[model samples]
Target chain A: MGRIYKKPVSMTKIAMRYCPGCGHSIAHRLIAEVIDELDIRERAVGIAPVGCSVFLDEYMDCDMIQVPHGRGCASATGMKRVRPDLIVFSYQGDGDLAAIGTAETIHAATRSENFTVIFINNAIYGMTGGQQAPTTMPGQKTTTNPYGREVKVHGYPIKVCEMLSALDGPIYLERVAVNNVPNVLKAKRAIKKAFQIQLDGLGFTLVEILSPCPTGWGVIPKKACEYVDEKMSKYYPLGVYKDLTKKK
Target chain B: MKNMEKYKMGEKVLMKGNEALAEGAVRAGCRFFAGYPITPQNEIPEYLSWRIFEVGGTFIQSESEIAAINMIFGVAACGVRGMTSSSGCGISLKQEGISYIASAELPFFYANIIRGGPGLGNIAPAQSDYFQATRGGGHGDYRVIVLAPNSVTEMGNFPKLAYDLADKYRNPCMVLADGLLGQMMEPMEFNFDWVDPDKLPPKDYIVTGCKGRPRRIINTLHMIPSILEKHNWHLYEKYQRIEENEVRFEGCNLEDAEIVIVAYGTSARISTEAVIKGRKKGIKVGLFRPITLWPFPKKAINELADRVKKLLVVEMNMGQMVEDVEIAVSGKSAIHFLGRPGGSLPTGDEVLDKVEEILSKPASPERERGK
Candidate 1:
């Protein structure tokens, strides 16, 4: 008999459509498990962004609003303000959360809006055929940056966690990876903690997860997971950039 | 909060169109207002800041028009009435959110106090946005209820009508006023019973708050091609129903008129004056004003073409609505157009001169037969 070890009650029976070894399914499962564990499924209002993950409503069993690209934070801020009783969070990818939506993410964090932001940084644009992303590492090749990213030309990678840490409003900021078993467990903890802080009526919270995109990275699934561990983590370190609770 | 009546019902007050429109939203129980400052429409959020606060609501002069519209989306999703306003440039920024709101079927109101523009044109009165409003302003095949208010009283009242229609259809409605109507001072009455948002039926579809309910999803994406196509067809059915039911227009002196002028908003106001002057000069000229510019009162225009020999369209832009008029009349009447773009407004006498010029041409047999 197959014994169930751990699962999420809020995840739907529908099959996931993510690519092979894509970390999005893992991130979604982690968030779903966290929401189920916290018993906030009934009150959770999720804002889905405009990328490959735009279909979060298909998997997440909670109330979900699929928003346009780069508008996740603003949409969540609006719903959270009117229905503060509900737990509102926006799930966004690197391009949606960083480049086009930079203003929304910054303003929402600076306002300390009482909500949660789950940012998935795969270092490349996966949905749009592996274009160079704002989070794409230097000396790396992408569709837009075929010659490997030059620092002077593309500018340095956007350290979103560090940039957000400088802002006064955000109460929690952490960066985690989901490359291996131990890291996957740690990523779950960070995601759960971000949601918990939102439940406690804390200020804005963000958890940057270094997701793997084997297709975008032009590698096999195993190589993609290994690349996230060896290469991605170096540029985006695994730690808490800011925690107001620790300060207090 | 102090115990005082914030507004006097049935009280006549001198107010600008933008101020009255803002207060009108307050009376409509629009509990949330988020907007960015743009020329010709700044008074809207400035008045709503205090007025919405007095009503125990929220007002945020957001960082950009981008943030402003999405903020409105946030509150609207939570089942409260939310709104935003701007002129040309700010409105262009709001189109993305408008497409989202329409696709989600979120009922809300937004006002565009029209200004001269292809891009950051100027803070002057113009109806250049007619095509944008009548046609869907953003991507996808969708339609929004567009109300063109001519007078300050209409400016004060159209927001309530817009919101009512918005809730009735679960669609977005816009009050398309211009800088001239928004900035000019006039006496307007404050009235209309404010409906409580709590009592509204959208609670059935609102995202979660009071626990243990089925999760509601407000979305626009239907990835499966057939399913998405079906969704578009459903939206189209609703739009067709709206077109049949919501066409509104005002006709002045249609009987025994040889020439008819078509216009709306400020141009209609000037055309009304022109019709009076044309009548005094024994020129058989009249005015046809389309209030709902999208549904367009096409039937009236089509029917009038059977009688009127000549038709002229006047606007603050360069020949936008003429296309719609051409479709309606179908060459049944000889058509003429006069417009002043780049923020130029044609006065009543100037429009009268155009009507006189049109009347100077003797009606050919084909023109008289409306061929």
Candidate 2:
């Protein structure tokens, strides 16, 4: 059959391993499509942290090193400093970045390491049986937070883009969503722009993408997208939190 | 603005053991160092701050021990020598990354200035982490090439040896020394020039932009169970080669000795004095020092097992290396252990007293030689 549009070459031939309609597949495709378009697949080096995204090695074609819990950003920092020729990036989740890896994320950004960070914030720990993540909604119930999350006990959800925007080191910081066709298009552009900033040899750049996690949310795939739009978006508003490139 | 530090090339220079380790890395073609400040190993990063940069390498004082090890992982994955160092507790924090490095089979050299521990233990010298160092500190079926250096000279010398052994097996190598060794100063000479990057072979697995080659993925996440098993076996086979080819030890007066002291690191240095004192007292005693602690000098110990009547194992820990000595002796000789953990060191006279006590005990006649 003549090809009208085929899968991105940056993604491997292996079948997708995420749950049906999970936003990970779409996000992975967005990144792969960006790498292919930029023509940097040969020089791209990605670090996969210990989470559901650990399976990224199976899909991402460029050089990769799967690190332990919460060390993706630190690993990418090391790779980028030593091999500035390679385009380095780290793909992380809410639990990996906001909680377990908070030190690495903040330090890497404060150091202004020239790499891209694609943070997928689904408001819950999708791997390891749906535990409460640092980004879990105030009233959201999870395995660890069996009862609906209470404000006094569970604390508030972390707005990563908002928190990181306070820092002066990062050159670009934006929050996007992949809840619908319009949002998906914005998310893809945000991901591509973050990578472009790195290609320009600028400082730290990150895109926080609010995506749907159907199995973790205990909802059908279609409803999960609506939930991301209606619920998650209310607390984690989508916008460009910081844009040093425009200021420059 | 050149700093006050200056030394003539190839001339003997007085250096601290930890600083010697840093200098050794520069001479060994190490290009990256990512470390956090710990008690005894603080000077390593301090020395490397200018040394690595002066040699046209990179140095990153990571936010924490966990971050430093992961940074080393990145440097190693990109195909160059990288290192991180800490004390016992900081090393405990680094176990997860160490496991990943071992599983991924990246080559690098790290130095551990053994300090007292169980928690945020004291800053004094202690070897209580022998099990953690030798038996694969991380969670996996893997062993690092462990080199236990006794003097500041060994500190200046072991980095090249450790890095070479690491690249030989594509495994992490550890330069195991105690806080005393790190604190002491000694004059030493280097075998090669310090700024020569062309000395060692270029990394074959380095992912330097992957020019005409297929994009490479240096990963350790094997989803399939059988695939992981195969990787483990591949590592095991490599370890076997290491065990066979790299067993190293130092023995003094073994042929005529009735009692042999088995030790390594700082304890071994003291034990050598004990051997000397015992020999002066007309007691038949000797020292068997293990230079390589992981693929332990078992072959030599097994051979010496036939000669010695009893082996007195001395250490600055609560008897960590005794277990390996026991394994090597294989019930061929009686093994006696004397240790002082928690930052206390057994003196040479104290070890001599223990040697005398063991020497006074009549040799059991029924002990079969080489059972």
lDDT of 2 by residue, B37-79 (tens): 9998899999999888876789999999999999998888877
- Clash pairs of candidate 1? A78-B74
Candidate 1 stretches with Cα past 4 Å from truth are A1-4, A246-248, B1-5, B364-371
Interface RMSD of each: 1.6, 1.3
Q: Residues A46-100, candidate 1, lDDT per residue (tens digit)?
A: 9898888998888898888888899899888888777788899899999999999
Q: For each candidate, what TM-score against the reference?
A: 0.95, 0.95
| Each prediction's whole-model lDDT (CA) | 0.87, 0.87
lDDT of 1 at A216: 92
Model 1 has an lDDT value of 0.87
Question: Model 2 chain A, poorest ten-residue lDDT window?
Answer: A1-10
Q: Which run of 10 residues does model 1 chain B get worst, by summed lDDT? A: B362-371
Q: DockQ: which candidate is best?
A: 2
